[model samples]
Target chain A: MEKAGWDGFEIGAMLRTFDGAIQNIATTLPEDRAYSQSSSFTASVADWRIEKPLFNKDYCIDCQFCWVFCPDMSIISRDKKMIGIDFDHCKGCGICVEVCPTNPKSLLMFPEQKDEESALVEWPKKVKKEKEDEVGEE
Target chain B: MSEIKKIKNLKEFSTSADRFEGANLLCPGCAHSIIVREVLNATNDDLILAASTGCLEVCTAVYPYTSWDASWIHIGFENGSTAVAGAEAMYKALKTKGRLKQPDRVPKFVAFGGDGATYDIGFQWISGCFERGHNMMYVCLDNEVYANTGGQRSSSTPIGASATTTPAGSVSYGEKKNKKDMVAIMAAHGAPYVAQVAPNKWKDMVAKIQKGFAAEGPVFINAMSACTTEWKFAPEDTIAISDLATDSLVFPLYEIINGTELNITYRPKNIIPVRDYLGAQGRFKHLFKKEYSYLIDEWQTRVDAKWEQLQRREEARV
Candidate 1:
């Protein structure tokens, strides 16, 4: 407590006080499970994603739907307006694209490998429900 | 009195410190993940959160590592309610002892548990919490099944949904009983506040949690948790599925004030047939078969009856 100058209130609330137990963590952790040290730099789950949501500022209505519904807090928002998707932690579930209330959705899902700029170029202005006849043509 | 700080602006709240954030192994689009964030965000004061053994506990707080930015503790499955009661009492004791310098730094006491824990396993402990008049909140992320330990049928699981334990076979139908009315049960405790909410209705959940905190005594919130893994839907369809749930009246959003007055929060523009809801998920796939189509109709009738009952309750305001 003296080193960090933490008061009794901090310790009582357990808000921001590092104790001896936390500093000297046990060396032998469970071996079967893949684990990291507590408060370690958490690894991103982006690798689990098959496709990523690409944000288009032009079409965005800033409805805040994407921000509210994002399970991962991946929808980066500023001043109540959603600006971008946090790819570092975002395991692209296409929820933002699903919840986007825009006609031509402000958020579009594209191949995970593609960049936002390139993905925006291919964004469908209006997604048409193609008849089975056209589907069979290809 | 000043209004509780509403999260009208996102930039105002610190992202990493204020609420539960990323870096856990919860599935890509679990609805409880969003619900957890909303519950945590509703409290402006510091928090001492307790999570029972379930999806929220195992996946979010792995021993010392946790996504929850608050002062979090991992408790046993049935310990959620009772544990928070102790915490709240301790806080009161600290206040008496003059340990806490700031008078308004009232840390919120909240416990979160899954359907398996909240609706069934830990219900006794939860009931005790309310009976004791503990100044705490218990939030049930009801996914309707034991999704953590591979989807088993719980009391909250809807009738006819095939679970691991209650598998649909040639002779045997799925879960034979109706989903327990957990909200009604919680309200029976005469807690100051009780409400049912879903993550799809973000504002409703936030407002309800805010009200829960504002209440004097114990508060119970039964939030619909859309478990994509067990419910057999695409991860992205979590919101749409939950929307369908409310729209179909399968899970109505309502609140019971002082454990007596009933207020229907959100009602569908046009109620969709329960068939559409039952057919959307893979768990109820067996009910769609030619031999079992009658069960769907039976379910629809029951759903209509339940909706009418709720409407009548709302009309009477009892």
Candidate 2:
């Protein structure tokens, strides 16, 4: 889930109908989660996996309450999109999940026991590019 | 006058005469002059002023016409705390090194800035200075708006008041946010002395200023300054507006010592409706509507809550 890159064009279209990025993110999630939006978006279960999805939009208010108060910068914004879990770096501390202001959690930690399933995915391509750029600058 | 009072002791040092005669850069009837005058009268100590860039800065220190009688430094907007904190540190360093002459008579340090600097831009630095235990007085001359910069809204501007930035138009009614509780913010940092004063009542204001300066540690005084030019009220209405504020309890006169003891000074005999205060300023004309009565109610609720909390604290202290 952390490695998946969002379709920017589709997200932009969804934003016209929704007031906030969280609502748009809810729409793209697999229907099996049984999410619904009634005044505010809500999910059926308190599943931790659904919370860690990337929000690739300009919805952050930049209150910095999140960053300043966040025990972990796990809910990070890269190029203005809310991305989650640099898996190697993430300690699964669950602090990011706790501080998020969204009614339904915005960033969640996948259970540590599910290591085999989580390791099956590749690291985000953007993360690789970022490392390469840093190397070039050095 | 009745039998003239004589100077007996330190208490007899009080005077009715204004010390800020030709030096005041504030406009006629401007509330800053009242505060400046009171501060001047309270002490003869050689002063070092750290002034933030605002109305007081632009008006008083404009080119050659400096209204400040003491040695003054005009730091950039929003860094009054850092500048004053540095000055305090330097003074302490010089004294410790035995480089400062007549150390006992060395100037008292003060940082003066408008609400914009104190409540918003310089809040972090102000908190930092307070926590570090700087021995100085920080005065926030709160006229509610960034008046010198063309009537823009500031963090201290009351809700439902209109300004250039928070203008009343079709889409919006007025400033959507409540005025920032700056005193509470300072108190949260564990400042030793914190007070709010209105200059219209000279005696009360003068007393608070003297006490604030005499405090052993960092002190913050939020003076309710009236800005005629920006509020679009008549210059002569400055005192009247200030009086209205107190009468309405919109801007109460109070003090907090070490974030514990709460003291209410001069509670008005007659508490008027908030409308009377609002009616005095053009910025609140938009709030005359029936729908906006809720805003007035909200203001009253907040005032009542604060007053009750203060009373409770005062009782607890006793």
Model 2 residue runs over 4 Å out of place are A1-138, B1-25
Error of 2 at A65 (Å): 48
Candidate 2 at B242: error in angstroms? 0.6
Query: Where does candidate 1 clash, by residue pair?
Result: none
Pairs in steric clash, model 2: none
Q: Candidate 2 on B76-113: residue-level lDDT in tens?
A: 89788778789889988998899987666646678889
In model 2, the Cα lDDT at residue B72 comes to 69
RMSD of 2: 27.0
Chain A only: list TM-scores of all candidates. 0.62, 0.31
Taking all chains together, the TM-score of candidate 1 against the true structure is 0.87
A13-76: candidate 2 lDDT, tens digit per residue: 1112122333222113222222222111121112222223232223333322222212112234
lDDT of 1 by residue, A44-123 (tens): 67788898888889888777778778888788766556667778679888778887877678887888888767777877
Model 2 interface CAPRI class: incorrect
Question: Chain B in candidate 2 has what TM-score?
Answer: 0.91
**Model 1: residue B268 alpha-carbon error in angstroms:** 1.2
Deviating ranges (above 4 Å) for candidate 1: A1-37, A126-138, B1-3, B7-18
